[model samples]
Target chain A: MSFPGLPRMTGWRPIATILILAGAVAATARFAFGLGATTNLSDAFPWGLWIGFDFLGIGLAASGFTIVAAVNLFHAKEYEPIVRPAILTAFIGYLLVVLVLIIDLGRPDHFWHPMVMWNPKSVMCEISWCLMLYTTVLSLEFAPIILEKFNIHAPIKWIHAISLPLMIFGVLLSTLHQSSFGSLYLIVPNRLHALWYTPLLPVLFFVSCIASGISMVILESLILSRGGRDYLPTPLRANLAKIIAVTLAVYTVVRLQDLLARGALRELTTLTYYSLAFYAELLIGFVIPFALLLVERIRTSRRGLYAASLMVVVGFAFNRMNTAITGLEQYPTQTYFPSLIEVFIMLGITAVGFSAFSFIVKHFPIFEGAAVAPGLHHTAVAAQANPGFLSPDGGDLEPS
Target chain B: MSQKKAMLIDVTLCVGCNACQGACKEENQLPPSDEKYLSLTAFTALSKYNDLYIRRMCQHCDVPTCVSVCPVGALTKMEAGPVAYDGEKCIGCRYCLQACPFHVPKYEWSSTQPRIQKCKFCASRLAQGRPPACAEACPTGATKFGDRDGLLAEAAGRISAEPTKFVPRIYGRDDVGGTSMLYISPVPFEQLGFDARLGKTPLPMLTMSALSKVPNVLSVGGVMLGGIWWITNRRSEVQAFEATEKKNRPSRHEDNP
Candidate 1:
């Protein structure tokens, strides 16, 4: 049931469990009370952190699909080692989005209505169908790993046969829904502020999601390496950094071009706060990451890569919030603020997702040889003669 | 092929009283959304130019973004007119909330079972041989509903008859590829809370152009990948063939040996 690089389960379990319990309680309170009773959502702004963080945040986190597609479908095996973990993070992130959405829905019970009673005209209906299909595709794509963990090789060949097709289909579906999310906002031409309003919002959403997805995976991998003491080789980090840098560069250029083409740049000078934020998002999220990764020296350096990834991650978050909340605040008379319970529910949803991911990863053979025993470090000198390249089928678990 | 239904909202004739708002609520059987659901409330835009109480509601866009962008068919425009929503068909994803240009579609963010609600232009009433509650209840005859062409003509007639009394351009006539809900105001629409910069193009048309490029991007990406594969494989094939030919033919190495 063992794979190549699994992490040990001893430390993360208790902390994850506590967070999960707290999250569940918060979710329950949200469902019991109305949205006004829960968080800060107001009339001026209908969507808040839940829409921005859970939906847009997770969408960007799905860069795992792009990387996996490039490596597997395109035969770039250099990215092979990072593929499994990237897929795992994306799957978990999406699962968290669904949880947040359930808590956010005014009538969670009617969630299935979109499926049973289909409306051919609703954008949300399209989004729902696509999200459902995409979720299934992601799970199926990640199934091979799950099966490998279980040593249930009975259907391994069948699963492997479908992997490439599923990946192709997943990319297609993700593209549709990701862009559709922005298209949803295109309806409010008057409501959404001009500075943020562009017919190209959907395109921006699609590009940013790709850039952020890569950023998130890179960040996640570095954290795992530091905390788990796993060998996150410099070469692999360099390769990832290069991908982030290039994509971010493209994203920055396209974003500015969109603004200029729309003739909304005039508003940039008039609206100082939005203009600053617009620049901040582009500079920190895209420009900084691009600059850092462009340098061959910095790409190889762990500290530089980490800092760049962190900025991209934070910048992406701000961008999503700005688009969803601040961008739509031109009509200050109708300002929307999320209620207290809404904030708690959002926090709870995040905690639950994190806890669940930690639990599943710990119990499963996901980390494989990454999980090392405590005493193994002390015996490193003695074990030098036999470098610990764990057997493909079975090996000593390492602490990561 | 068919005539479009339209509403002509004359802001000059509108009184500051909220009779339209009350009448709309009565017809739709909707509770007061307070400030939480601005779109559903049949809002009035208050301005400094004579304090014209402009009735704000769905524009009934020619190409509804909510309909096209919706993954499911939850929001649809009927031939009879008005974009209608089926609550049972809604998955509670707020894409409609995001896509609407006029901010017409409002979400029940507080409800776990939220359905997107907006003015359906009283499609049911239209079918039952009646005008909308707001139009019927307007004491000053500020709001008029009729066939799209008729409304446009009426709007044009008013502007020409009293050139000084109305704005030259008709609001919603060409904005976002023309809306069924038309507006005639003495002051400019921008002063009356209208988005003059929406341009003449439909929102859906803008999105469709970009979406079409997706296929081109994918095909180009495919060709590039395929070309790399061909180069790599071709080089290996040539190398193997040369090695076999050398073994078959008498080589310089063989003569030396």
Candidate 2:
């Protein structure tokens, strides 16, 4: 049966297909020739695009736990509609992170080593357990949609029963690991540039991730609405923007306070590349967005919200990259820029995530007005509610 | 049987001869190459600082950050003062590379089955009651190996005997909470390309301070979330009961009429 609301076969499909194919080729080459031949990674720079982007992807995915806790644990029923989409985004984001990790690992086959081998002192060990458990939690949280689509009743009840506990546990796990990403760099005070390194790195990372997480949800909601799925209400968008602004404000205060306390604020005044990058990160990523989001008019305006959120997403990516790469350039004589294969692989993984999301949203009960009860199936209910959902030949249901 | 072994390198007597590097390669059975930094093949290397030659290798820290940060316990600091690696236990995460203050661990990027590479302070040689290959090959007694306390005392004596000949400080004495290797140099340690800013506190303490709060966060967060859930659910239950009562009362009035 043809799925309703499946976007017509578009030019983007072929482009995505070609990128995936190229990515596959690049991945194969990476396996055959090894990291030295395919990427700019070396002993001087063991982590590159993969590690940096992993941080960003995971940070953005923080919305999954935030929204889930709001809806399920806190009983904020107004947020229930957005929970599924947030979880889906998180699931896809985590899947991509694991995929990139496997690609980047020296022995991807040994990825399961952390399960049996325990290192309680290791932050990496803790992160590994968190990633594994949280991914499973996300899948469980997302199971209801899949189960409802397939008219599975028994599992749906089980899922609903455990969801509350799952959400609490999930939030705990996300909070620990998200901040641990910053903790990973705490050991390199001498190597990491003073402009970025701080003892408060963990707190900074956690707070910034919350802002970025809310920003990502807002951006995704806007994209979905533009795609003809009005899943998010206007007031909800405004509220989300408000939350983003407040989180960013607090994050800014804490970050600057930490810098001042450490007496590393002087580094920011130096006429050097590190200082320039730091200023750019603070201004474009945090300062501008924070200022824009604080105004009621701008926070309510779709265009203004979009602009601020975009800045946040871009800025957060830069922050993570700087922490992982630029900050470590103090001693390395060989500068690092991701090779073409590395770039293509990253692009390809992104394309795959986007395509998978679109496909899942179309087939599953992702959007509101899409019934999520067992035996109530998506297409039948969607068709009855909106006749446009019944376009059999895959033509545009509404005027574009 | 012996006290924890340590290396005392007197940089003032060290020549630029690369016999130490060659000896390390021979002892480790690593392939020969002109790698400036430590690599999978070259566990120890020499860097020239002006007219002085400084040997670069793992510090084998007393409270090693690498040992603490390794998720699989692949890297461990032995009581014998050598940091040892078990390839079988390594998941190849390379977190040790990021955690090392000295940036000592190296990866085999060219190998499909990669393992972390670094100087283990000649752990095998220590077990056999011999000094490290580099220390054994040093002609000027620039690299000395013995009990860690003994080395520290000897380093202190040299600095006191010729107060103006060498720097008063012993590098790695308390840097990163002391290491198995110590250095006495005529010039400042920073001028010899050392990271002199590394605080005396062990690096692992930084992360442990953050991680120690995990239990508190989990327990407190769990109780808080549970309390919120209970309150919200209770409110909803009360609202539902009141609505049902109002509907029943209206139905009874209509029935009586």
Candidate 3:
């Protein structure tokens, strides 16, 4: 029998592919004609939906790296099952961010100038250099999985040697650029509305990235399990929930402190949409998820866990957009609803992320118990029966 | 003649006529200010204080924030005290736009291949030792362009001589770590759309404070990762060793076998 998670096609493949192609075409048009030709960006709103969603969206989707590092590198044996898939998701999410950057740039050809002509004073220069370096580091971190697919063994041993340094580098690089993304707006004090403009913006951005990344890991795992993939080990899923629970609690407290420090709490008393959004971001995104994940019963139920994770992810996305767009938009009443082409382009990039992830999982030795169970069956029965639909390697044939 | 230099804008001396705006377009060979490219390079701004025409341009600061943040050195502060741009070197990252505390750098975002467009402080005119177009075209002596030291002393002398006519302070003297272009307003500087919160500190210093943490974060992160890796790898190795030793041991009843 075929694996349940494997694409059965059922005729939906053609439709998905066509939609993705349309998105790619629109994205190309956006780049060729200039941002003004497609996007609704302006001087008041220099960064529009693409930078807001694609960069911040994928950056929050960064849970894959931190989760994998937490489990595998740290030997959190309880988290092992989720590690490989998390890394795969992170790799694709990051690649999409780079793709978005290329499109967003006014002069995409000169994008490489940051590499050779480094300006130490500019945060953008630092962000540019770090992003490129970190992408390389991530690719290296994901190499063992790719190598395993081809049955390559000798170099696999060296993976351990480089893994430690790379993991450290990955975490450091992620922190700086994620924060630097906030620093990009640090100088825009007057233009950026008072609500989002604070000296603590960078710190707030970093904390939110951590909280959102953990939330994303939990969400991805829940979705994968529901899709009837090789099941996530119970222990690993629990560990992810616990991480999300703790991080959310911390994020909530920090966000409140920041608001208080900036004396923004007074503004919340006004019965405006911004005030409502502020409370909603806190309540749904952080408080609710943290409380639910803490309860053992909620964590144990598959659906409950899935719903909580999904809410947190939505909450995180809303929070980032609220700061980047909605908060700033209130100043001059400038409207910036994404055009149709812009929406399609974002959807297309996400499709690419999903497709890349699907291919990687099918080949890699991502699941731990998948290989072991079949071998045990052979020894117990003394029958030369075919291990039905087992991969050719007899073990969970690791892809490399 | 060397390109005319210096735009001495006397905010106190005249009414807000927009002759300078028209002259700047003509001098720079720029098109009329359009809605699509509503940049400060050729845009109009009605001053918040008493509706004075605040013809904004490159301030040419002593410590130019634009110069500091231009990743490719596309924007450089010349020895003659003008901040100049090299379009060929501009990658158009627009950090210079964000970094400029005075909010001077503007972009041609409407174009597919946009370049940063900002006031050059009439560097070309300065090279020719001619008065800048705006100051020259100004019908009143409200605007002047001269040597940096001369301007500062002149500003100081004016403030002392006519304290009642102008505010006690000179704008841009200490704003954003000081700029060559000085402004003497009758009203408060904040009322004129100037950012008063920008302290005596240079903008680049704030960014450097954060970037300095990079090496520290990396070194500490490296050690922590190494420690975790060692523990995980060690545990598995010990487990494997135990398994091999267990298999080699003799059983109590199978000593002869």
Candidate scoring better on lDDT of 1 and 3: 3
TM-score of 3: 0.86
Model 2: per-residue Cα lDDT over A108-186, one tens digit each: 8788889999989888888888999999999887888887778887987776667667778899999999999998888
The local lDDT score (0 to 100) that residue B105 gets in candidate 3 is: 68
In order, the interface RMSDs are 8.6, 7.5, 6.6
Worst 10 residues of 2 chain A by lDDT: A373-382
Per-residue error at B68 for model 3, in Å?
4.1
Off by over 4 Å in 3: A6-15, A152-161, A363-400, B1-8, B32-51, B98-101, B231-257
Model 1: TM-score, first chain: 0.84
**Candidate 1 at residue B56, lDDT?**
74
Return the TM-score for candidate 1, rounded to 2 decimals: 0.81
Compare the candidates by DockQ and give the number of the best one: 2
Looking at model 1, give its docking quality level.
acceptable
Off by over 4 Å in 2: A1-10, A331-334, A370-400, B32-37
| Of candidates 3 and 1, the better by TM-score | 3
Q: Name the best candidate (by TM-score).
A: 2
lDDT of each: 0.68, 0.84, 0.69
